[model samples]
Target: MRLNLQTDYALRTLMMLATHGGQLAVDDIADAYGISRHHLMKVAGRLAELGYVVARRGRGGGLSLARPAEEINVGSVVRDIETLDGFVECFDAGSNGCPVAGVCGLQGALSLAVGDFLARLDRYALTDLIPSRQLFAERLAPTSPSTSPP
Candidate 1:
């Protein structure tokens, strides 16, 4: 069960936003993670559309979390970012071409596993993973005063 890079970038972007106190330019986020600005832009756009972030254009404009990190559920984020509809052929009733679509336990087991994975995520919010915004900033932000050398 691997998550696509899109989801990974989404998480990273959210984490970056949560730690930084102010609006962050898309280029800054791309540079921070050494990812493509073009790709990051797409991710940022989707996040903004989902209401996880708010984006502004022009000078002094960028991205910021729409709500507090504590209010954003990791499970909901995963659910929004990942496609979980077809864990196994049986899960997708419309196009399931498997011969034993209803007779096998494989689909059921996989479904349960996928459900449990998401269920566990429901127990935590983004803040749960990054409790100290300052600490996250200090370690990950290249422009952090603490990370700079004398």
Candidate 2:
């Protein structure tokens, strides 16, 4: 099961914010991760819209998690970013071109696997993955930063 780049970036962005706790500029996040500020801004906007993070403007303004790390479920974040739950070609409603689309056990099995994956994620919060925010920051600090959109 592979997550798309958008989802991957969303997760990374969330992890970064989760670790920061305090306010962080979008530029700092992009720079820290060596990712495109434009893409990260889009991700940040989605996160803000979903109530996962909040954004503020001004000299000290930046972004931060809306809730405590312990309250934010990792599974919920992934679900918000993931457009489809389909694991196999037959599972997609738009393109079920497989010859055995209607009678395939593969589709059912894959669905089960995807469900299990999400279920496991549901059991964890961002804090569960990283014990210390400082540690997380230290681990991610080596990456380059990018310029965020104003």
Candidate 3:
């Protein structure tokens, strides 16, 4: 049940944005998270495409969440970034090489596990991660100049 690095980065970037509640540059996010801008750019592009975030250009432009933190569901974010959730080769739709694939209890158990994972995420919103908006605002204020809008 390991998420890909892309999905990990996407979540991290989203959390940072949620905490900041302001426009954030790709480079700043990369630096803060100690990730590559190249990698973050791909994640950012996907986020923007999915309407999770908005990208702006020019001197006063950067990126910000398309909707408020409270409006975005954590489960939706995970589902959007995940390409596949197969825990075993037989679980994959395109390749079920296992001879007992159709009757295996393992597949059902794994499916339940995945469902539980998503269900837990469904209980949370992006705002749930921040806990305190004032604390996040204070933390971002110091890094504001580097990651600020524009």
The lDDT values for all models are 0.88, 0.83, 0.84
Which portions of model 2 miss their true places by more than 4 Å?
Answer: 142-150
Q: Which stretches of candidate 3 lie over 4 Å from their true place?
A: 134-150
lDDT of 1 by residue, 93-119 (tens): 999899987888898899889999999
Model 2: ten consecutive residues of lowest lDDT: 141-150
**RMSD, each candidate, Å?**
2.5, 5.3, 4.7
What shift in Å separates residue 49 of candidate 1 from its native position after superposition? 1.0
Clashes of 3: 1
State how far residue 7 of model 3 sits from its true place (Å).
1.6
Q: Choose the strongest candidate by lDDT.
A: 1
- lDDT digits (tens) for residues 1-150 of candidate 2: 678777888888778888877888989888888889999888888889999888898899889989888899989988988875465668787977888787768877778888889999999998887877787888777544564324
Give every collision pair in model 1.
none
lDDT of 2: 0.83
Per-candidate TM equals: 0.89, 0.85, 0.85
How would you encode candidate 3's per-residue C-alpha lDDT over 36-111 as one tens digit per residue?
9998999999999999999998788878999998999988998999865556786687977888888879888888
